[model samples]
Target: MKNTYITHALFMAMAASAFAVPSLAQETNAVADQADSGGLEEIVVSARRRNETVQDTPVAVTAISPSQLEASAALTIGDLQGAAPNVLITSAGTGAAAANISIRGIAFADIEKSFDPAVGVNIDGVYIGTSTGQMLDFFDIGSIEILRGPQGTLFGRNTIAGVVNIKRSRPTGEFGGKFEASYGSYDQMGLRGVLNVPVIKDVLAAKFFAFHNESDGYYKTVGTGQRRGGSNNENFGASFLFTPGDRFESLLTFDKQVQDFDPILGPLSRTGDAFAGALPAEFVDGNNTDNVYRVVAPSQQMVGTYSSPGVTNEMNLDLDVVKLTSVTAYRESDDQLRQDYSTTGLYFADRDQQYKQFSQELRASGKLFDGFDYVAGVYYFNSRYHIDQFTSVFFGAPTHQDTTGWSKSYAGFVDFNWEVMDKVRISGGGRYTYDKKKLQTAFTDPSNAGASFTGDKNSECWKKFTPKLGVDYRPNEDLMVYGSWSRGYRSGGFNGRGLTPFASALPYDPETVDAYEIGLKSEFFDRRLTLNLAAFYSDYQDIQQTTTVSVPGVALPQTIVSNAANAKIKGLEADFSAKPMDRLTVRGSVGYTDSKFKGFIVNQPVATGPTTSISRSFDFSAVDMIYAPKITASINAEYKLPLGPGDLKLNAGYRYLSRYDQQISADPALYPTALASAPTDIITVAQNDPRLRSDAQNLLDASVSYVFSLDNGLNYRLTGYVRNLLDDRGTNTSFVASNFPVYWGFATAREPRVFGVQLGVDF
Candidate 1:
């Protein structure tokens, strides 16, 4: 029974850390003299790979500094999602290389290249395995953390729903620099820059950064009205720091990012209202107008494209007692997807995608005796992905799609923390991973459509060992309490846009998790109120889903990939902050997930003409759990006004997300099709069948800033923002079927009101 419930959760977390370490050092010296008044300051984190003080780190992280991501204009990572509570960064169809990050409610929204993404997108500490160009745009940042649950023994591969580190800003020996600019509202524009140099001063130093942005495309295109999800992008980076002594250090880096524009394709409305004439008249409804971010009749699109580049080499050595690190990395991306699924321009699609990666890591952290504290690591990874596509329907027939994929991994990890006494603390970690994958295909043979189908190969391998156990108790000095048990995995490939051979030769397995967490971190009154709480429970196995069948005389609809399903997730999170006066500050967060689906089955394709057989069986175990979402909340308020040349901040925030659903049988008898030729005219309602769900949102954002301060040591800042601010168009991604063989359900909207202005400088 799951190893007796993981050995009774590691013997009740080692008997509650050996009887709570003798009453937490006498209740932490009687609450350390009633906290001595103070509020909100310490906020350091590494989520256990080092650094501490996130209220003494019990995990369930959510850092986000850099002046709170520049007063929430966030510029990427899906605008850092309402202060992270059940995190969900998305983009699935636009810039930042189509991001789709998720945490807590693990997700892997497809963009296919051999899918794998259950949350894990590191940067700086390297690790960005695929998801082609996994969104990037926050330059020179110095923090971003967001580790929710199941971090798999010090972050080992696909963290099963958590992990998003992203630290930047290094190399600063002396000399400095900074710059910024912006202008917004549809014609948006932006620029940012930074520099730091002092070669050989502190043994060597150099750093640089740059970014540029453009906008104009929020949707609009109904028969050539051009514009659809816009934002041209550019970025550049550099780093070089060599300490050369003093506990040895080194860092060498390089970066590049580029993005052309236009591409969000999701606008051919007509959802609900049972059948609405069963769609397909170029998607009914006045040929595209009922503006849900508009876009009707678009075809043969083309604009920027996309490209990404990266390189890194990091090293550290303080080997006195321990502490040695090394990291080597390389990354690459290239893409071009000119889509226009007949939103008018009459059917078009030209696609291409590519990615490459290499990674290496080695580490050894300090203090392994006395009070204990340690870390050990080893990892190596490799990646490659490819795809090509072509289509042009309009009057019919014209197709091609190709694929190539690869992956490799090896890992070993360790972590430990003792402090067996003095207010308790005990931890453990483990990792063993080993994975391999391969897939290849180049098509043109939908059963002889043009006769061509090379050896379509496939390969797979996986191994796992994930583990972690923890306990923390501080009883006083502002309180702290914790518990944890973790495990995570996600690896298994094949099915890069399948169409035959049982969908790309078949391969799918690795997808495991087992997490349990409990937490509490407090700092009442004296600390001016700071509260944190967490609760989690997870258990998923062999659940890598991705389906879209239909083969009876197919003309596209394969896209397989399966491991059936099995799930059970739970959650509860909370975070708070308050200042009440001292310039007023108040933050908030709340989350509650429940997810279901304990089993599922599938095998579809109902009826079609001439030589077409039938097979149907759908069981979605009462579906529900795609983008999890059972309730999410957020609130923020910042105030400060002593204006007249400096200090004048004002910000507002509010967020909520409740309803959710994106796939897994939105019903229609599991999507039939083939409307004509027998079997009772087989057609099962259209446009994202099963009732595309998703509604329940309340976003609102605002900002205002002013800093100014001069006298040689410069400082100046100005800001003004408003995102969404109540221009909710909701539905951020839905679908019934498209890109051939239609069904009429399409969606994608969110990002309506936006207004901006920013300027900065600091020396």
Candidate 2:
């Protein structure tokens, strides 16, 4: 292990030297112009609800521009896996529209609407309440800002990890449009168009965009040859900017997206386990090999469909002394999924869900004194959801479950920044949040004479006051040092996936984190080299862990949520960018995280005999946290060459991630014992199971483009890109189900090598 760490360190150092800088571009300008100037351009960001240069923000943030996104071929949110430090984003496996996002060791992957994500995703200043439809496609985007660390004060609830703020391009009040088409591996095809028009000159401008993409899938089922991991997606949106006058402005935007796809699931059957004799022969024979792209199942294909519609209105009024802002938004989503979990095709499940949310925010910002600026806001959010699920286990009669839930949240926050001295500044903020949740569930079993049970409606409320304080000292024009401390909160909720009434009605406590961070931002070598570094430690308390527990009179273990652990997470991040020459630019970043559970005690069901069981407390404090990779690094380089009538651009990127635990109960010993005389070899084999761990991975991508213009004021570009150049098909996530009759698991693999070409025109 020590040798492996040393090797990784050396590789990172070499990659940094070879690449040299950050690839993210300035928000409002072209990077090529900056390269020509022989110095890095200042990046502007809105991390603090105001426009400020990144170097002056005193926060750890990375801003990605539209040109950078295009260069990296980031078509969707999941494509931004290694673009930032200490962040991970991937498909959730439940559906194509869902995402599992982790920032700085904090993550949540379940699809249950009752559960809240530690990280927040905001679009055009409107927060997405659920992870179900957060994997948004990229189109007509202006900027993407990744704020690392707790954003409790300004972002309010459930931002204990961080926030991804996406800003769409506003109407330009010009008559212009762009169209593009692309074709890639696996028969993938895409088309996109954007149009901008002035509704009324100097008063209103409108922008409209439409996009469509389809693919034939990467994996196939054994015997049937049914496709999996395929998707057909469509998205369209329109935004109208109403200026009316210089003192007031309003923007209204509407968007809708639809996804039709197949869920991805790779079965990993344990044929050598203690209960192997009880397993279906089909399962054992079908998954005898270790190929993640092929599976044995009875179903023709699993189906997943999702659709969401949303509308937002943002109005601003600028007074002489203060500026007032109001944001109102509403969104609705419908999701359907059919999956085969047992891999035998005989055991399958179906889910239908509907969700809706509404939010309103009012804020005011202005200079409060000679050196002080303040921003204050009041926010309200309400959401409701319903789910109907049916499952058939081990070829048994299907069971039905229905869940309904709602949440309401209210918050008040204030933040202020004061330059007390010439080179010293102080910032402080706080937010008080009150959240209320209600849940009800019903279950019916057909095998038990159609027995039905309904859980009583349960309601719960939680309140929290989170605060932040920071100070920064700038001793020179090109250098600044800052330190900060903050607290973040996530609300409590009932278990919506519970199989029994008692478990469904049970409530879990809220989770909170206290974080401390210090950082330095600097530039050297005549502004040609920029380096930023940060180190942070976070204390996580009352972690809401989702686990399985045995319920009396139930054949299968019930999924439950509990505040079962506390943790300590510390990390270091470094980012640098350099203009090595006039035509070549290099960017690189490295992140190191050390996450460990401080206290993890949970009750497990131990089988003493064939028909008897007992619950015992187990200490699992030594286990590693899920999705907490120890080391993550990336290097990217871009070179520009003057062609005959245009500029030729070549880009390459490499990303690396160390092995990390993908499941909470990764240790085989944490599994419930079958019996005292169980075969020891089965346990030993399970201990070395490769399906329980996500191995280290290295990925490479490259792209080339040629841009030119015609004399008629028309612009054209041609590009070729390839992702996963090395075809590293490592496990992205693993799901272990040891509480079942046998030790079985399923895993999702990273995307394979894909190459494509694209053509675009602007008129």
Candidate 3:
């Protein structure tokens, strides 16, 4: 069956290419005959530390233009999932500001500062140090680039999977501005505006941007009669450009973001009726029918609030033969989460965290000789992270934990490209990274208030050398094929959520990946059609896995972090686009990934007697990797109609993903709800728990827009759009734990149907 699926996918790709070639040829001929020549627009990107056309760059990347983002109404970073193949972005926990971004089936879901993200997120060449505040709300003009596979050489560390690069629009030395507003379902409202001023004409300029949006949630709390997942967010930023000379320029920017919202934690099933009176009657009943998109909660706890403020300064100097640049940045965030965990209103958890980061990078890029170009850089990063919070069940039996950590990283890298022959080029690069971190933790339980539950300070360091080598051969101006081998690395750290002293003292090791890929990029029929295909195989070592396990006598589950095992992942990805006619455009992509573990084992707590307990290991070598859907595909189409006074545009996109698991552990005991009998001393449920699995998903989005010219150098655009048009049930996060003698698991739901209308004017 697997072979059959692969064969079918390959056939589909070939068929699509075959069909596109003929259409493109016909269109080119017709255009030439009619003298109405207009080819596909070229996209410029900075994926490899240099500005180049997407088709000319030797990397697998997807660039989303500002116009496309506006048309799709991508309010946040998480809405970029279906835009690229083998990429998935989901919210972590219930906070809209926490993003779990995965590319090629690799992601780090642990919400700890010690652990760096596998996929790197950056803005204007400045890296975002933590994932807690990575889910930035979208606003203003600019572009977004998604780079697939490891980017360890040019992008530095923590890019083992890929990178998401966001570049904001800068002052263009023109006096112009724009304003936008939108209204949507559930009383949603959005407003955004930007202004640019020429302080000194060609010498200096200033730009300011701001955005605000809010919505009443779709789900309502049964008892409080209030919306459970409502959201409110706002952001503003300013930038100043100083061009003192013809060869030197500097840009300074400052921004602040604020988010206040409640997350939707839907319940699948409830048992024991422990808080029957505290929760809604229907929610307490295990037999009650489930509504995937709705919540039945009584607590309706306070909102989770997150705030971030940051500043960056970048300077560039152009010499006769080389360009020198420097980027310095600082960012800080405060996050507070207060929510009911059990959905039954039986247990509420609260957490507060503060984070600060500073980084600087110096780089130089230019040509060394004829047909030879190079880029080199040095980077320094430092960060301070703290967490202090208390958890209370039934508003009593409070448990408190206070922790703080600091990290420092330094790296130097150099990349060189040489044209060995007329149609072939060789590229090689390497980076040496040194990482160090120190942490201190304290835990206090009122039930055991008199006992000592703290750990001493701990520190660790790691050093690694990662390299990349590739060869690109261009047989013709319209076609290129490339192959490369690369090494990726990510440093490890302590688990911030560990409940026990022993667990807090133990830390995981750094992970490494060796990847090999071969790809082909081609353009046909006067560049009216473009197609790119890539196949990759990766070997992952010392994979860090996170899981929650019950202790023998502890009142709460402790988070355990360990080096799980080795794994192998192989995949194929294809992206294609064709402008069949001047008024119509078609785009599609398909991704297939197969990931499996080897010699995998997980630790579980077992009770040998009423007073004795021990840890046992379970083998799960055959288990599949979490969040790795075997098949994912998407298709998009857009058409435009020119009228006497205006232009009408219609757009639609559809995406599909296969079933996949949402957790790292594969313990058999985590599948069943309870023990088999009262006298049973040992119970093992089974692997591949159905409760932790998410069904396949299909999502459709469509939009329509009208645009026309107005008087006095003003233009207006109006658009209406719908997301999740089919209202498919989609799960984002899954949780499982042994809460006493019973094993229960819960899943979180994604957004439902959303329809809105937007209006904008440029003057």
Candidate 4:
């Protein structure tokens, strides 16, 4: 079946290319001239760390421009969900400002500073180390590029999946500014402004921007009628561009972001009636319902705060034949939150964390010979963090834990592209990376006077050499075919949620993937139509799996990370854009993924008595991978009409996603041995947990805008937009606790339908 699918996909792609040539020949000269005058807009990107048209780049990537963002009403990073193929981005339920990003079935959703992300998010050439503060608001953005598959050679560590490269707008050396304001549903309000000045015309320039947005949450408490989920976000930044001479240039940037919000944790326990006997009627009255917005409230309100400040400096020098570049960056973050899990106030946690990081990179790129070019670089990074947490559960007294960790990494990489033939090119590169990490932890229990202990400090290191090879064939200016093989690696780390000394000090092994891909890029009818397709297969090894497990003599379950599985993943992607008429444009994409576990072996813990437990080996290959949907597709269209001294534009989009699982340990066999057998209700509820699966979803959005200019040399635009037009609200994230009395689960709701109006002016 898999072979047939691949064959059909390739045949269709070739057939489309063949069909395009004849169609172009049949067009009349008048139609050809019309197409030449009004065709699809050209897109230029920096996917390879250099400027090139999207059709010329060999890598499989999607570039979103500022105009596209405005048409889609994309205010935050999470709004980029359906803009690319085989990519999923969402908010982490546990953290207010965190992003849970997945690419090609590889994902990481936890909010731990110690663990690294599979997908890399790079902002202006600086890689973000942690998931915290990654879901940034969009303000003065130049461009966004999503690269699919492994990019290990050029983009170094933790790029096992791919990279989301974001570039901000630079100083234009002009005296100009822009301002905007908005109001929306749920009492939402937003304001944004940007200013650019030529400090020393032709020599230096400065740019500044600020953004603020707030909303009165959509969800409401059952009895108190209070808002459950809402947020107030702000961002401020400045940039300075200096060009002392023709040979040297420098850009310095500084930014700060703040997020204050309340998260909604709805109870969806299957055994709600069982809890009714012990808790008040209001607490369990509406539990286990399909609606996600109305939930029981705890005695104390849930609140969270996240703040981050960062600075970056990039300098470039041109020596005629060689261009040298250096980038220096530093960032710091602070996060604090108080969470209520049980809804009845029986289970809750309070956490505070601080993190700091510094990095330096130097590289040189230039033409080596007549038909050859090379790029080489060396990078160094250092980061440290501390976390303090307090927890209270139904079966045990309150406990406090403190953790501290640090990591250092060094890497050297080089890449080259050589034109060996008239119409052929070969490219290859390699990277060598060395990483070291250290961790220390302490735990205390107030109920047990002598249960306090400090874990032994531990350290570990890992090293790897990854390589890539590719060949490209350009038959003509409008046609290209490419194939490549690459290897990617992710570093190892200790579990930050470990409750015991043994688990806290043990480190997991690294994860790696070997990927093979083939793709085609083409344009037809005088650049009026564009199409691209890609097929890829990967071998994943030493997979890192995080799971909750019961421990002897501990009242609550503990979380552990281990290298426990091997897998195979394969996928197909297609992207197309067309300008059928003078004022109409259409764009669409389709993505399909097939991922399966080859071997999954875990050490399952079985309770032998009230205070003792034993471990046994279990095979869980029957379980499905999380967030690996079989099919995802989207289509968007825009139409422009000339009005009285202005242009009126209308836009609409639709997205579809297949059902998939959201939890790792959802197999029935593991539940029997992993949880206690008493209360019979616990076993029944575990078998039929609704939080384990996410249903299929279909989303729709629309927007309308009008633009005009006045005699006073001013430009104005007014826009009205609606997202989630059909109001298809589904669970964004859901999970069942692993601790004792596992009869309940928690879930977070996706945003409901939102409508707003915005006005902008430029002078």
Please name the candidate that would achieve the greatest lDDT relative to the true structure: 2
lDDT for each residue of candidate 2 in 3-63, tens digit (9 for 90 to 100) = 2233234333423322342231111213442456568877889899989988888989988
The alpha-carbon lDDT assigned to residue 549 of candidate 4 equals 69
**Could you arrange the candidates by lDDT from highest to lowest?**
2, 4, 3, 1
* Cα lDDT of model 4 by residue, 520-615, tens digit: 999999888999999999898998888776676665578889998888999999998898888788889989999988677666565555567655
RMSD of 1: 23.8
Clashes of 4: 0
* Residue 468 CA displacement from its true place in model 1, Å: 5.1
Comparing 2 and 4 by lDDT, which wins?
Answer: 2
TM-score of every prediction relative to native: 0.33, 0.92, 0.90, 0.91
- Candidate 4: residue 261 lDDT (0-100): 82
Candidate 2 RMSD to the real structure: 8.7
By summed lDDT, the worst window of 10 consecutive residues in model 1 runs over 25-34
Off by over 4 Å in 3: 1-37, 223-225, 269-290, 450-452, 607-614, 667-688, 738-744
Best prediction by TM-score:
2
What lDDT tens digits, residue by residue, belong to model 3 across residues 235-292? Answer: 7778999999899999999987777787556654445322345555444333211354
Which model is ahead, 1 or 3, in terms of lDDT?
3
Error of 4 at 99 (Å): 0.6
